[model samples]
Target: MPGSPPNAPCSMRASICALTCWCSDDTRPIRSATPRSSMRSGRARSSRPRPRSPRKNGSPRPGPHASRPRASRSTARTGPGRSKSGSPAGPCGSIRSSPPRSGPRNGRAGDCQSPARGYPRGMSAPVAVALEPCSTGENPLWHAGENALYWTDIPAGKLFRFDPADGIYRKVYEGEPVGGFTVQADGSLLLFRVSDFARFDPATGSLSILRTFRDEGMQRFNDVMADPEGRVFAGTIGTDDRGGGLYRVDTDGTVTRLFRGTRVSNGMGFTPDLRRMYWTDSTAKTISVFEYDRATGSLANPAIVHAAGPADGTPDGMVVDAEGNLWSARWDGHAILKIAPDGTVLERHAFPVAKVSALCFAGPDLDQFYVTTAGGGRPESQPLDGALFHLATGTRGPDRFRSRILL
Candidate 1:
């Protein structure tokens, strides 16, 4: 990247500021962060082709909708009283520093250097998968057949898919706030919205309702996942007095309620072996595990494995990795928690902004992590709070189970 432009675009700059880089030289004790409420997570790799220009979010300056970042001491601005030279605005609006960066950079921009300090220096910084943040980004899914990533902005009622190959993305649906969705065995998307389910054709952008609820008002599919047998376990954000419920939607169209006591049903995932199912309840601040029966599609022996105390952030969306570990997003916590199968807090990847809503593994090899966040539509949200981000975590993830619900 020797000839790379002096002014990196907003995507690269945004990735830098939010990066919590680690290194070998500096040895500092990791301080304990008091856990609190939370929710989700990015992409750059050498194996892929170079990215195209950042046209959608390449604005060097902050727009009326984007949050303003603080200027770097070495940044020069073009306006009247500013120096008029240096890099562009980064995440949340931070200006790029004029000084040269040293070390090995993980992504395209330059040498690897942490925007701040502390932690083993990783090889790369988290990449901004989507510069345009969401107002409730959740449910990231990697479609190997299409070689792309898909996710939703719940409040905005928009669905988007991104191609890692060229750094290009397009909005696929815009009529409803999709709480969760799964790629069908045939490759179409089965969208679970507020009160109904839709079959979405990504290729043509055409969608048709699959099912409609009669009395489940406000009982949206908050989050869900397909079981190993093409069945889906859908959790809901039920009405005030009723509380959220977890239901099973089978291929035959018969629905069964498995559990019915969560305040806000959030994320769900299967254990690597498919023996256990993990569920998150944001309002209850807990990640519970249940005995999963793939043959019967029933859940039993439910137990609270990881309960987030006031200090620990509320667990939002979650997924199981290839290693049998759980990676969960913390709402308002500003970090993603990597939890062990036994529910131990293994590691925490911090974010620059709050409202980290959800994440998933994407990329051809399934080694990259794509994250989503919320609060993008709010005037008080942080710069990158609503943006979709990614990182090349040296870990592979399990394949997402496909839903085969008959229409």
Candidate 2:
């Protein structure tokens, strides 16, 4: 793998730094009912890093699952939790080894109503209100100003924008493996593509590279966020999960390294008051919190905010809502967790899909939350893999990630 050195402890450089960057979700979720209490136990420590799945090995295999074509279905009802065969349906309808002959149908084959439907605690399943059938869809960000949602498909090397206004969508950029993006004050987007930060002008078809980062230019940016002051903070990941770092890019095009040794840095967002910054290392299953100095765009007092459960899932992308609550996409857990500021999981709404990559809020009132779920390493044996999903949390997210001013 590129950018990784054997026996290295995730430093600034890895022996395989020359390899290509790899983007895959490997986070374990914390799913116990207890908070501040470690309920799930019995984890054996391993000196070597976890081995890559054999199926995902090689030049990088295509996402295994294929999705059905778009089908118009009524959003009013999500049908019951039972399959037509009178069996308890798993998250996805019938788990057939083959893909659904027709694309996703809206009725209730394994469909559970939304939380608003009040099926029962732990019984309500997340409904897919909107979906983008992109393979390997990862980072999801809700741009309130545009009244749309933006996310990236790393393997596909494309950026997407969905305008809820008319349900119109556009591919803003292509040929760049964009993992995460932050809006600029001028409405342009700053994105990291294969270890370099660049300003992308969707309005004009131009990509201006600003600077190169970790792995000595061997890594690609994975996830990023902008603070209230418009400073861009992002992370990087290499092929072998080594030499990834978190960096800050100023509006003036100056980039500074804040922290290094991150393994697949994923989700990021600031607290409601903008007093703290939260980030996650997907592979490590660790989420860290930092005290922020808004006046200077610096961070201090780093601490582990939450370390997810190993078997449940790991943290992928995260966002803070208007209520000062934090919501995280649990990659393997098959759910998105709503967490309190102090790292308490207030609620978790399970998704039919396991690879919930990232999330954002939309709808007429910004109360509707949109999530991008991936098929993990390979496409699922079942169809409906890599499908976009939407849910109405009836909650609002914090003001959009304020854009950093571009020079």
Candidate 3:
């Protein structure tokens, strides 16, 4: 978030500048799926000026229920569908919710397979895989081609990979702080950083700027995911007074701004059926789902599936399970939550570290869950803090779509 890109082109700034700069003239009215209350301003400095008018109140308010997030809604109609319980279901099935629990039921495996069988010697807790701790370990991605796992230490500007077969993990790239990245179809990397988004090659340590932000002081990228069509949806972090933005980088090399005032867009994933998309806004404390249109790459009708309570730690990176359930990592809560579609807490997997940043299903069969942690650079660091964790679970998640950018 602090560093500037030393290598970037000048093509992207003009068209996308008005979107984040929040200028009054060119700032178009967006059909935001998130509520205004959840949105904060962005920190990107805008050189343009706007005339101010006297306002009696903060901003004009919309009518009642006009922008309220719905708790229950019908699912997208990808095709014929049925609940896991096997009751005949509609294409637009709505999940019924149980009352929220005040606290995580420690060691409770409501529906997921227990961790006891996931370890070699029957160790139930998550096993840390790294020898040293990362400053802000995040963005755990599975590279199926290499049969290994990759993650990043954001503050340290380090990228690392772990091979379970030989029990080896090392830094692969060390440059500017990389917020997130995706594995390309050709095995290259699409890196989203503070100054620009680019393509990175591991074998030759080569990186080329695909597009660069016009402004160097804009917020840095945070999390990104490749859609079923291989388009990437990326988000940026918010600054002190402003929220960030959510953007879609098309395969044809077009950039589109999907939402503004996004407060720390942290994680994203698609449903098993590929008809819906799950998004997390950490500062808003809400996980929202959208009806997705794969043909045109758009989202609509956002509903809050899970809203974190005061006790629920800030939600960070997230992924959808094979069964469409969502697993979210807690920043300060020291646990990973497996949540049902109806927003019920199915399982709570606790870790020794306080900052559980992100997780993904990896390995050949995609049966293992790789996790990342943060706060390792702190003076009072724990043994496992900032280390990558590998847990062999009973479930398998779908492979992330191989990116085909600039197609």
Candidate 4:
């Protein structure tokens, strides 16, 4: 834990475990392992090699995705097209992959590499979206109620809706930099816009300010989710790297502060039965879980779910599949990570772009995944910088969490 810093990629094996950073395709493994602590100071001590399962042909397992050719890390392009500068357009916008990052997730790590690589072996591939670049695309939610997808652009103050049924996407609303939101049981939407909880009506195209935390004026809403009982929860982030917190908004228009001291609150999701909750703190590079009392609507027994180093990229938005695995968007890591309930990373799906913001399951069976990314957290000046991405993970996700419109 001491060696792992709070903002760098974990060492090589750690990166493999915690980040599952394959060179090109998510299915392929790295050709060789690197020494830990060589890339940076305060790195973790070396550990024994992990036991890999036998390959299909009974040959010694080749490196990850041995079927594919490796790409130059400097090239930076992973998907279909590349820019003149060699940086592929991220799913969100024109963000180029910077030099490889070095930092710890949650400021720590110890013997967590093997299981972190991916459990039960199959990696999910994310399809890069082809859309105009956005300023800072973050949270994405699938509206099963309307059979549409909704997402927000934090910097652009824009909200988007995509109808996969017809392959048409529209910019439905623009607000004061919304960070995250959830749908209610009554078909209204709850959002964390600016410094408070607000309601948005898709039918009338109007927004109503419902609750505020002025003390957190500098903080904006980031990640949001809902419980099975229809309780809404969202995370907030302070501008300029200050701090962030998590809050809960009930059906009766009550806002409750649940947790604080988080740095860049990111992904969040509830367990299948709604008895547990999980969330991410991006800057901290850690995902934490809590036990929820369904009847009382209270959280207890907090625990660490997963923590990634800077190399693994920061965790952003997340969604839970019917199998109970958490698929998270990785910012700066160029991958979408799937982790088992026991904190073991099940798979790492490479994204052509370096940023993966949020993901949701769409389609009639909830099997298709629609992910949103940004262009390196900046305005897009390049081609295909911020595009809507699609992936067929062949897994079904939970039901859509719709907000109960008080209006």
Candidate 5:
């Protein structure tokens, strides 16, 4: 009746025919309470009908179906494989979502999107160890000879080892913060402690000083590794009067300065041919490569290979795989990036925790990857914040050569 043509009679017979024609084509299920007049209103009034009550912009008035009930927000589908909430089922069959976050939390970026779809076939989620979590765990080292794993909690000032055969974990040393260490040829440990370097013999529980840095103006040692020929390459973080420096400690305990003027010196690794060395400067957010002379313990022709942006997170510890690729732990990136020899990103493995610190290949075949994390200075608790994790990599790693430096 509201939109009848001027010459046509507004009769029930014509209205019912128009409404039937219009209602027959609509595929949406009809609501039981919809009125007959509303159905008739949806039809075209006539070929030359006048538009009634036109809005300012000339759009048609909203129809009765415009107020139909919408699908519930919780049941809506956002994309092909995602729910309305943007959380999809993860590899472990668990719902995982990345809530909106502002900036880096505890040195790590916020949670990332769901993991890339192409994780290696049959690779399960990382498994966390049941041992006590550390305040800040770093430098995970797998000792193949002893069938054990070793790591340090820097802030807690404790060194720990786990025996997989018997499933036992024990604290080997507790004192000044241990930044890093290497397993000696005779099963002893050469420890790089807060203010000095020391040797600890597990059999006798004896701690002997090898060198002290009381007046060097260095804050503490950060990372240390042994070359194939037994020379220890160690780096220090500077104090008020100095900048960080990289040093080469020879078998005879002579420390030679290799490089200086950095802020935080971290993970180091050598290529399979021992011709190139990779070093990380956490404060600079860069990983650099150098032409290395392993025979002489010299580094030359330094060049930046990779630099992390503000969102990529800082590079921490690293290890060279058998194929000469570098696997680096990203402190706040929530992942480990496998980089090619020429600085190409080959693959990435995401973690549940944000502060992924260090990783190493372990197990008899070196096919297991062990990862360490940090929990210090976090605003909220994470499921695996400071726990040790292991994943089956399906690839073997190079055997760790003992640090031959005599103590």
Candidate 6:
């Protein structure tokens, strides 16, 4: 009675009394004596007949068939009584919908779902080997002199090297988180930790800090590389309230800030002539080029070279081939894109895992492409998510320039 309409008269309310009952027990039938069409029309009066008025003593007169209880109407309705689309409502008054039988359903395009683990469309399956599952693996450097490969597990604070000839994997160093590093001219390693720059001597197994950052509010260094003249160009992230900046560290250990306002500074590379520099910002989803001055380690006239769409993934680590084509590792797009100098995509290589962290040219001829991945936050079900992968692309590139630091 409380939820019933308030404006109706007693006779009308009595005639519609059965409709007021809530179907609390779904197993029981809904008590409705009114005709289906009349109930659908929501009208109170019936066209068949009108019962006699109550007697003067206040007792209602008996109808012709009052003794028998009326059969309840079916809960299901059709025609005009149905929903606007002519479909019956669900039990909770909501329209039922089904999932699509085929095609992309999550706003992603059809191409994003790659077919195989190592092979993308139009490409053969590259050989992928699990050197070691790492939390965050980066900076794959192939030492031609030693005929071995070296890489870092960032969060694990460990350095690893693998020898293909003997098939032996060894841990060479254990220290702070190494963001990036460069091979020195003297066969040592120039390491850039989160807040400091250091040099590690593999011959003697010793690490010496060259420079330490004193800015407590600045985030750790994200990427680093040495120029042909031995100048270290590095970038740092910022605190919650500020953006990061790029810096240059000279051979004499003097640091100079070059540019600011970068949210997530990442991979960087220089052209063969050392005139144009390419830098990527993963958060901005853009790869920008600048007129570089190798003499002063300075950058100017910044312009975007490539910007990824929402589904194209963020550009992570990158490298420049001998022909000047840029190979970029896609962070979440599950593919790598090779772009020409004019910003045209020349090739695309897809992977089964979604997080492709970094790539570089390896092997004696620099014809092998080595890839690194991140397993820090990935689910355990992803088998190849954080392993190293490589492929012979039949292309050559210059070797990694040695760092000439005065140690």
- Full-model lDDT for every candidate: 0.68, 0.62, 0.68, 0.62, 0.66, 0.64
lDDT tens digits, residue span 97-211, model 5: 1211221112121221111124443232354542234678898888766777788889877777765553334566667888988888878788888777887764455788787
Angstrom error of the Cα, residue 294, model 3: value is 0.3
- The most accurate candidate by lDDT is 3
TM-score of 4: 0.68
Q: Output the number of the TM-score-best candidate.
A: 1
lDDT of 2: 0.62
Poorly placed runs, candidate 1 (over 4 Å): 1-124, 214-218
For model 2, the superposed segments whose C-alpha errors exceed 4 Å read 1-125, 129-132, 212-218, 239-242, 376-381
Residue 202 displacement in candidate 5 (angstroms): 3.0
Better structure of 3 and 4 per TM-score: 3
Lowest summed lDDT window (length 10), candidate 5: 14-23
List, residue by residue over 56-96, the lDDT tens digit for candidate 6.
Answer: 99987777777977644221111211122545332222111
RMSD of each: 14.3, 16.8, 23.8, 14.4, 22.7, 24.9
Higher-lDDT candidate of 1 and 2:
1
How many angstroms is residue 374 displaced in model 4 relative to the true structure, after the best TM-score fit?
A: 1.0
lDDT of 1 at 317: 88
Q: After superposition, how far is residue 68 of candidate 4 from its true place, in Å?
A: 23
